[model samples]
Target: MNEKSGSLIDSLERQGVSRRTFMKYCATLASLMALPPAVGRAFAEALAKATRPSVIWLSFQECTGCTESLTRSHTPTLESLIFDSISLDYHHTLQAAAGTAAEAAREAAMKLNWGKYLLVVDGSVPMKDGGVYSTIAGVSNHDMLMDTVKGAAAVVAVGTCAAFGGLPKAQPNPTGAVAISDLVKDKPVVNVSGCPPIPVVMTGVLAHFLAFGSLPELDKLGRPLAFYGETIHDRCYRRPFYDQGKFAKTFDDEGARQGWCLFELGCKGPVTYNSCATVKWNDGTSFPIESGHGCLGCSEPDFWDAGGFYRALSLPANPLHVAATAVEVGAVVGVGVALANRAGKSAAKAGHETATLADLEK
Candidate 1:
């Protein structure tokens, strides 16, 4: 076999990752994905004999934050997901080649691996004026993406920018920026959406692909369900505080100091989907909520244009009105919380005002 040709386990072994550790990783991933233990063993076996796939990373109309998230953060370390598993053939930020030679390298990798390589795009593609807004080596982002995607086995739209048109496609989009999904209809596109998606989430998606040779189960937005299955609100530790109506009205208040829910302070966690609450950042240090800030809902589409960051989700401010609205609207998903909070604020008036989980089900 050639230098780049080998099973993943063999390379991991050479790189100092033990089989026991690798298997443990597999088991964790399997459980995280809601798969049986047998599937973990199957994954381990599949990766042990599978050939490393070639990956081409393209960047356009974006900050380099997405690149930094994976390369700079060492969690789910490079030895397991990046360096030893996939042959990353082209990455604008990481590769050493420049100018014509760089373009040549991309062309060569595409030609050699034709129809089998993975295509990863991290930024939005500008469509105005034939994509003159953003270019690499004098080639437009639109042109390059279309040309490269022609030969890719599957396309991974990393970060919210590439997945949902992000900031580049915000109101008054000057560049006419568009997401990868808007362009690539023929290929199976997997959207990993986050401002800079959790690093371990990126790792998990890649690992699933390497083991199964197919994209993981996806949500309605084409995001991997393994990672995007629950909203940040679902896993947030402050959920109990929200249920109890113990809200921090401002950045500095008794409730705020007590670590109450940030919902009233404009947290979009209730509607936003991501793994930030669980996976976290900076080596599992903490996320925005953990550090006393509300979620900006950066993972969902058009979060940039969603409105003021400090503007709380639209709901009834008065408990009496909330109760009326809940009855009028049939107590929809979010209305239940307001009704529950009614009991917290006026415990003496009526104990029956508390909206039960069973009431929510009804």
Candidate 2:
């Protein structure tokens, strides 16, 4: 390990992080990685003793939302503290140097770390016109990426841009944008696919890598299963209203006022996989659905192109819906029949059961 990498771990210790806090971080990391409890202690020991790994963060054709999201993690101050555990050798957005000095720093770090460093990339790479659309220090983003990721220990493609090309690769995709996975085939790439993935998710992945020296288990889409295992609908609070067939027809309807289901208003929660419904945003204060808006399905690939935001998807044929409808109809019909039966019983009890009008006159 290099001096810079060694210093990073030392710095973390100096930052008032006690042995217990380090262990707690490890337990959290293990949970995030879906590892057993035994692994947590091992992770803690490894993180405390091992030298920090070098990390090179690259930016391509992107809006920098991923970086923004990463810096905003408030809990444990994980996002900011991550730098204490890794040698952040190169990040154009965060580095202090500029111009030739910055470029030189990147080259030195890459050369020194060699195959030991981790590479994190945000944004898609444009393949059109010989990749001229985006460049860093006169070097095309494509060449820079290829050169940096050559011997990386692992590559984390942050955000949907780097994972699945994001909106740049959306319909008509004029730039011929391609994801990091499309280019770096040899190295293991973990896709954290969201418009800008949750900050905790980003740091959790890094912590897992640092502790275990390997990528966490991924789902079929190469996403961390711990965070992306269930669809948003399955975890949404409005699911009960959906079951009861109470839906909001418009933004200002009575059902909307009652906080009913937003399925009729085009919620894509049924097919959208993310932790938003559970983890939520802004310190768990609220998610979209809880705020009376339908799910926008931001985590799913090509969510922007999925169709209109207010267009409802056809409900799947299920027995539950049929059963609920039957129960409702039965209650209404039963009330009507009870009223008729009560009227007949009242007349008979008044001595009108056997007497006609002619008998009354006689």
Best TM-score among the predictions, by candidate number: 1
Global lDDT scores for all candidate models: 0.79, 0.75
Residues 1-362, candidate 1, lDDT per residue (tens digit)? Answer: 66534878777777777878888877776776767888888987876667778999999988989888877744556433544467888998888998888888899999999999999999999999888999998889999999999999999999999999999999799999999999999999999999898776777778788888888999999998978898888899998887776878557778889999887666778778888888778877899999999988888888886655664554433211122322333344345445544444465345644432222322
Write one digit per residue (lDDT tens) for candidate 2, span 154-226.
8999998898888888878888899999999899999988888877677778877776677878888788888
**Ten contiguous residues with the weakest lDDT in model 1:** 317-326
Q: Per model, state how many residue pairs clash.
A: 0, 0
What TM-score does structure 1 among the candidates reach?
0.85
Clashing pairs in 1: none
Enumerate residue pairs that collide in model 2. Answer: none
**Worst lDDT 10-window in candidate 2:** 315-324
